[model samples]
Target: MSTSFAAESALASPADGTARTVIRSAADVSQLVNRGAAVGSDARIVIAIALGGVFLDAYDLGALAFGVKDIAREFSLTPAATGFVASAITFGAIIGAFLGGYLTDKIGRYRVFMADMFFFVVAAIACGLAPNAWVLGGARFVMGLGVGIDLPVAMAFLAEFSRLNGRGNKAARIAMWCPTWYAAISVSYLLVLALYALLPASHSSWLWRLTLGFGALPALVIIAIRSRYISESPVWAANQGDLRGAAQILKRSYGMDVEVDAAALRDTKAPVHKATWSNYGALLRGVYLRRTVLATVIAVASSFAYNAVAFGLPVIISSFLAQSMLTTILASLALNLCFAFVGGLIAVRAVPKVGAWKLTVLGYAFQLAALIGLAVVGRPAGGAQVALAIGFLAVFLLGQGFGPGSHSMTFASLSYPTSLRGVGVGFNQTLMRASSTVSLFLFPVLSAALGTKVFWIIAFAPLAGLVALLAIRWEPSGYDVDAEDFDAAKRT
Candidate 1:
């Protein structure tokens, strides 16, 4: 029996009610909308607000560095305690990413996003007011939940909002999150510096409170803006068989003008039936199996490599420089600015052409060389060694900036269709966060035990990632995400 409204999703038209457009092939999907699909101004605003969720993640994550010394001093924490402070957030992030990705899809992107922000608000304040290291660690865990939950939602949001005529180059658009993290850390450094200059050392301990609390502020701002402007994903909406509702949202929330031709949307609906665990079994079968493998390797590799640097920057930098806490903060922020942020930008421009797998492969190769050079040439307290470290760092970052760092998220999002996107990205993120958290926990001890030799150990992840890239070689470059949904429909 056919659905009375036809077998179509939110992109299904009510224009005539009976004759709704249905997509059964790629030919039905338009790479560029010729008519009736107007890109809305509100779409851009929504992207910004969704990205605010990511920016909040970045802020909280970055603020930890600024807070660490004060947290250790205030609590007189042992190395284990200190490690707990860093790794706890990562643990929460892993869980949250797993849950958030699945739940965001089960619920809706905006609902999970809003729900996660509240975590940041409450957790940020708790971190600011924690009486002891344990309490502070717990608070960081909460903030990490908020951070983890938002990442997949934010990625979904960015792609959905930018869905205009082959602008599937949304990775280029959303890689802004990388730079945003850099900016967050930079601001945190400046904030810490300002407080240090103005407040006494006794008060500087509390400044960490302020720095940690600052993570919530961006979330609040984002929530405010998103509430006013954001629309749920039209594609997601269509999948839910809320075509009329989706269209109304596009017009009202996003300020989209022009009629939505259900025909153009690759009209499809989300399963009215609830998906079960066996649904996950489907991802490992047939064509999608390769996608699953490819994305998983990328996530795992990016998580290991990125965490080796992003989470352990202070420890790594401390090995080389001896000026001040502020100097350490500033130098770490500089790497984010030059490497992570610019890397994202360069990726947005070039990734579509190079494809995710190629970029990831190239990134691993460069990262491997850079890590080897750093390990060989690195010497503690030597000027030339420091110079070499910095040089290798730049070279390493360029690889990340161009490939794994930028393309990882891109691949994560595009690797699956909408019905499965949340789960796919979520699973990928969870694994990624797991690798990152494990490394976060182990890095300090390993670095202490092995020092520059740690780089040698870290190099293996990317090498494995490179191998995986070759094994599962699908590139999610040009298809309108809408088409993937249609492909899924045909499979049924």
Candidate 2:
């Protein structure tokens, strides 16, 4: 080390004589984190906790899918009113995503993360106890706030804490979101089924209440476990010019012990760009503009299609089949478990090898075929028609779970540098949630008017998505987000 840079130092030695590092700038902090990940640090605890937020997000969102009908029946709701109830959470999510993104960057990741869990707990209890449609809608909107805020922080934690080698690679870690989401959805289904089976026919009203409120259980559990393991992101610390803080976090959380020369940090200056609401404009002005567009299109297209069909699965099935409520819920539960769950698991395993680009294209192709089949078959009147509708539904879910479902969040989160990653994902999720709000509100109204022709209209969303993918052709899987930005800056 230079004598000028060695004025302040802490000593740590192993079998080797000495190993000394200097934390002079954000780059040094980045290197420390990257090296820790490369060596396969105990990051699983961090990742699992981060992903727990996603599981809760999906579970809370999908919990209402089966309960919507009962909610309508109990509250004497019109179709428009029911649509509002379904859309309320997404509407709140739009605002939450926008603000949460800016706040995650402004405040520390751990602060924002721990604060949001309280939203889940309170809102979930309110939703369960809602006596009227208005109250339920209000409670869901509040719960949506937690769901929306949790995502950007959770994703940032996952990416920053992750190692770039072996199974802990960027794509694989990001791809884990899909399976966890599906797992949450499947669990909701099973919970509903168990409640339905155990409850007496006269007490069927309590079923939906239990389902909606049950979301609090997991939220509380995650909060309890995460508190013990949470650590601030080293990159965020480095960005703030706290080299010692970053080094301590690495040693304490990641188990990477090293001596950081404080004198070196005093000698050099790293660029300081704190995230603010104004910085959001930067996404559209420079190199990030194209990436922003691609992420938006994919996220919106996926959200539109998924919300239209999946969120309203109960309503769609009820229209086609004149079965008992038990039968309807059972069939929907089976479809998600067998088809969607399996597809998501396969994508989690296959994405690193197949690449995000190819998997998404293939998934869209499957969606196109299934939708066209639905358009031709219409609603199932006979035995053959019934099988075709069910078969096509399976194909569509398979495609979604296999392709866009896994990569939409992955692309947005991995496309930007740490300075802007939270806002990048927050913005992406905002548009997606907006799309979700619109789709959920419009699906019932449109389906009621168009009948089976609605499938034809919904099919076009995935087609447009396919076109966007083929045109852009940027595959972010396993891309070095930090290095790429430095390279670009150097070129300019």
Candidate 3:
């Protein structure tokens, strides 16, 4: 099978040129990565490195959840200012997602990968050393840039590198982002707990600083090893007419030895893709329009609900259980790691089996149920309140981890061609981050005003998502990249 597959992709020459080379299309690249022998060690390491960036993104974003209260206290922030501090990164993320998507497509994935890490390093340092709310918010916004930029490139690499068959394909690879995100969230909680326990009262101010600053360490590690381990996406390079460069990377990265014809390269007939502002409208037209809408709906809905609940979990739990700061931190850690992390793992496994549509629907259902439960239970006093609050919150996080939480990015990443994948994801993420920014900013205000009724209000986000998912039913799993309308448009 291996020999036949390789022979099928062996060297060839076109009518226009005499040179012979492997006649690899975007489809062939998909097959080779998905079903070929190259899907072993290199694939795993590449997935790890790319997903490692995901881990850091999650860590940096979530680290603030536990630290928000401490920051409010230390900086003497008003409620509105506290919301701004909590949501500052999200505001920056909106900008990052828009610009990063364009830059990723215009420049290249490798360059973006190398460049975005420093955003984390510098921003994390600034956040740790910030002396005022304004400075802290500014630093968080910068960190958001790193978080926002890394996602499109990382997801693109994962999809491009993965095969379409067997256990871990495109959907699976993208779904891994969820668990890695939860893992990072879990790590942040563990770090906060350890710091909270270790730090004396005199030096307790260092908890949030250390928690926020610690995110940089992983980014630095990713930077150190990324250049050595990661390779440029061959599909992307090939699409750009760099047959030799693509061939070299293929040979080196996946250990595939294939001949190349410099003369037979770059289909002159294939349309050149020069991205412009007008292209954003293309996502709203034809088949891409449907996908773009579905992805946006899911991403935005998920971001809205998750940010409102997950980022504010610490505060919500404290209020619900009427617990001290220490108790709240410990409880948040336990629930995040136990429920959210578990749900993420379930999602990773379920993605290949349940399919994106069913899994996402189930996830939304879980979230809906959890929200109702919270609203019904309201604020109770005593151990029953503790039990019910944890139970409902666990269900909410679990539903999220399994459903829209992970697949939002998965849908965005896989729904477009290499030419548009970055932008597609960027656009989806931009809207999603914008939604996140709004939700995070509003959650505190709403919670204060409406109390537990906030859960009922937030539940509507998932309901909307569920309706969109059931209506669209766009399953991106095992989708053929070459078949995207964008590619079809390019030829015509």
Candidate 4:
């Protein structure tokens, strides 16, 4: 229960001449994780699985992008109804994030994670076979819940499983979500393309359903293997005053042979921060308020711009550039893979060295400039002008890959320790999903009404993100935020 107890119990060798790490408290478990996992440890596999969850989030969110029009035609939906169907998932994500955040902290990461996979598999199948617009919308909403719930826990795994600092540090691991997200989006685009080619012209209308249904494949794969590779977060267990449970998790997940001290097991003190509704308010008070504000703004802005541009990308290309559907798909796919995905990769590799703040700033600048260029160019009449418009769109996505895209979650996850990580990311995602709902609903209407001028409105997103980053100047990379939990525990 004391600091000296933790220090003394940090390590020990058994009488049989084998080394066994001693975990006496939450701090001890944190120390082991902070020191990084052993090579080829299950900890790395856990991180990979967490990223797979992220892949699902991106895939489901984007799978419907190209098929909205088909859905509209098939369902005989009005523009307003179409908007509702498109935005329903985000609405579900909004509610899911709020609840999932609390549940993740209250129930534990493993339970929330394992349970959300069912949401994806079931919802995806329902979406594919829905009989009407209402059914499709409901199914998509369920899928959105899975996406919402997955992010907070996925981020927790990434942040907790990796070391506090280094090439693959917490910041870097968290930032990797950006590239993984883009990769998932690219994969969805590829799927659409493949289905488009394979499906006969007579059955082309089935494209959306088939694409959405495919989401179940990955979720089921993750579910089957989860029991083998996934384990409860050791720090969460220790925080609950279950040192024995924490030690076991370390042995299985981190490949560390650890034993809980008898005295530590006997000490049944309450955790530093019990999972409570009040913790949500804590994000807006005292030290966390500014961080919450900055992270929320960055997330909202990123979501708005991305949902508006990326989700509507096929439409923009087909209508604005006057291109065919095939051309639109290929262009969108190439742009995402070559620019957005590549940029995300750069951000992941560079964040550890260059810092998240600098890259985010540079990324926002690129987005802002690109948006302005698109606004100025308007609808391109000539071939060169068309190329320029596409170039601007590519630039905007490229900026997104590295800047707010990669670091928004970085700020959200690392700004809080394990105690508040779930709620922190949950709160951030809740607002971000709300923004997505608005953007997804409005982009079609706005584009129809304003034409290319909509780029000017979209330009505001990155600009806001840039302003927030400059004003706040809080960088999450390389920071030892987990120490806060121990400091608070000591105070109690």
Which has the higher TM-score value, candidate number 1 or candidate number 2?
Answer: 2
Range of the 10 consecutive residues with the lowest summed lDDT in candidate 3: 1-10
Task: Give candidate 3's error at residue 439 in angstroms.
Answer: 1.2
Note the Cα lDDT for every prediction shown: 0.71, 0.81, 0.81, 0.88
Q: Write down the TM-score of every candidate.
A: 0.87, 0.92, 0.92, 0.96
Tens digits of lDDT, candidate 4, 335-379: 999998898888888998999989999998999999899989998
- Please give the lDDT score for candidate 4: 0.88
**Candidate 3 lDDT, 108-200, residue by residue in tens:** 888998899999999999999999999999999999998889898999888887777557878888999998998888898888889888999
Query: What is the overall TM-score of model 1 with all chains considered together?
Result: 0.87
Which residue runs does candidate 4 get wrong by more than 4 Å?
1-16, 270-272, 489-492
- For model 2, residues 1-492, the per-residue Cα lDDT tens digits are 111323134355657756545556666666556655424554668788889989999999999877777999999999889988988888888888988898888887888889998889999999999989999999999989988898999888888887654455666677788888988988988898899899999999998899999989988997888756778888887776677787777766777664556564665555565788876887786668877888888889888988888887777777778787777778788888788878887887786677788888998899889989988998787988988898999999999888888888877888787888889989999999989888877787889899888989899889988999988887877666755433445212
Which number leads on TM-score?
4
Task: Summarize candidate 1's per-residue lDDT along 386-422 as a digit string, tens digits.
Answer: 8778778777877877778777777788766667777
